[model samples]
Target: IHWHMNISNQINYVAADEKRQIIPYIHVKDMQGRVTEYFAKDSPLTPDQIAKAPRHRMDCVDCHNRPTHIYVPPDLAVDQSLLARRLDATLPFLKQQAVTALTGKYETGDEAMQGIAKTISEFYESKYPEIGKTKQLEIRNAVDELQRIYRSTTFPEMKLDWKTHPNNIGHFYFNGCFRCHDGQHVSPEGKVVRKDCDICHTVLGQQEGAVSMASISGTTFQHPVDLGDLSAVNCSDCHTGGTGP
Candidate 1:
């Protein structure tokens, strides 16, 4: 980002390892307040505007989260909910096709499935007219069908040992806990590089008797125990631990 990691090009990493770059699409904000359709479609991010804050910082969690990115900022991935809604509008039968495709395969005799597939392809071509050699759009087609499965709230059995400790107890956004939290923030590179608390926060001692609305001070909520408290819960919070928070 313009703030950390790649700051002013002065901080060169001495870890002696390789690095990757974040390919960004600079989005331009239209300040002219034009209302006409012709002008709206044409406004785009100019090369200069994109170069305003040129920097590269990589967080392994961003790229590997499959289809869903947890630790990434909004600038990275496309909004799934919004895409589903848009795709739903054009093809009303998307939900049924999705259910059939996911729960079971679509019948070769089905006309609806065939029709939906053709229209959906054309729809993607219309929206992302410039989608190039990358197979991203093709993948999106598969995901759109899966999104129907998610939106329908239908999933196969997922067994959980309810007696296990709480690893993640947190609210979910676009997905049910199971859909997103199938894997913890752990990545394969995690074996080589550990994600310590310092990467994101400084979890100070708990402030005892502090008001719910009060901010955390250095000294408050002092549990009369050592650093490794018995009820450490192993993790600070969890988002998708089978049966949620």
Candidate 2:
């Protein structure tokens, strides 16, 4: 079975008028002597032109490229830790401090482990003395979790980390889907690949602080920070899998 079947239900089909461009397709003759024209809704390529063009058979790995060897970024790692209660969210500045410690330059794995522990411990000890003293266990647990996260995602010996590899899964930390659907790949007829957010999946709900927003229909994405004209920019332009954007 094809992978598209798995996510077919999630695909939000755009109206005919809203579609900016159609995917490039061609006519091919199979070994069974059947001639099939794999064309899009409004593609303008002639049969002769398409026959002369290159052909690529789509496969799972073409999109799902990083099934293993996954490197989680510091910010995302910290968020996962907080969600799973591995890191104490009650500790103020825990996310900020953890990411800082992880993103800091270190020569070796041992140095990174030591640096992460020291960074988290010292931050709480100096900034929030009361919490540091009273919640010593929480701080220690957070430090331990952070160190584990650092060890798993980062390898100073090989000079490798999340940033070293591009995980083409989503358009959050890297230009995953946007590489093809960035509204720039135009055909001769001026049709594009279509960069609409709802083309793939629907964002059912979003939460900001105490307020939560939801819709039966998908809602437009809201960036955490107020950066103007996000549509014009790729996510990877700003999100560099680091401590700061």
Candidate 3:
């Protein structure tokens, strides 16, 4: 099981102040009442204050979003305790959501839940190489029910909250490539060219398993360097003070 944000476009309700305004609050507690974070909208904390905050804070789906695969870790890679609570909560919601995705309504949610249960059973049965004779009939029955549902409806549109720009706190608290080099806006206006493979280098063994990181021969670099005997036109060769012609 995994933990991800279950909300979107979050408007925090903090009526503790005089004005009844919903601040952009991130719910930092899970079902087990663990503090995953302590983010507040207007009450920005200083470095010292932030340092004093707790390490673990829990949040809903608005914070833990899935991008293709479950890329985020730490806060998202759920354990047994959290998973059980989430499963109990998610199963009912999943039924409603799946039905909505299919028929655009929740009326069929009960039936959808049954179908989901059967599908899960079938999936587990098929996961093994071979089932015992005793298990085969049960697996068959479960799978047959799931298959009926498959013909009955389609899947939902998978949505994700992704990083549109750099520097904003990540969609998740995990390692991601977009955390740094998410090329959106730049200062030097095209000077930091959006790079492609062909712009500076070429991929030789694209289909092959192993490929070289070194520059290919004959691709003369714009900034060339010369040594006594050998000549290097590629970057890093002379930049690192290597002998080149």
TM-score of each: 0.21, 0.73, 0.21
Ordering by lDDT: 2, 1, 3
C-alpha lDDT of all candidate models, in order: 0.31, 0.72, 0.31
- Candidate 2: which stretches are off by over 4 Å? 1-56, 205-213
Model 3: lDDT equals 0.31
Clashing pairs in 1: 168-238, 169-238, 206-220, 206-221, 207-220, 207-221, 208-220, 208-221
In terms of lDDT, which candidate is strongest?
2
Tens-digit lDDT track of model 2 for 96-130: 89999999999999999899999999998999999
Provide the lowest-lDDT 10-residue window in model 1. Answer: 34-43
**Model 1 per-residue lDDT tens digits across residues 195-230:** 233333344554446644344543333334455642
Query: lDDT of candidate 2 vs native?
Result: 0.72
lDDT of 3 by residue, 1-245 (tens): 12333332222222222321212223334455544332332343444554554432224322333424332221121222135443222222233322222222223445545555554444444554244244555444433433344333322233222111111123122222122122321222232212222443444322223643344442322222234322211222322111111
**Position 79, candidate 3: lDDT:** 24
Worst 10 residues of 3 by lDDT: 159-168
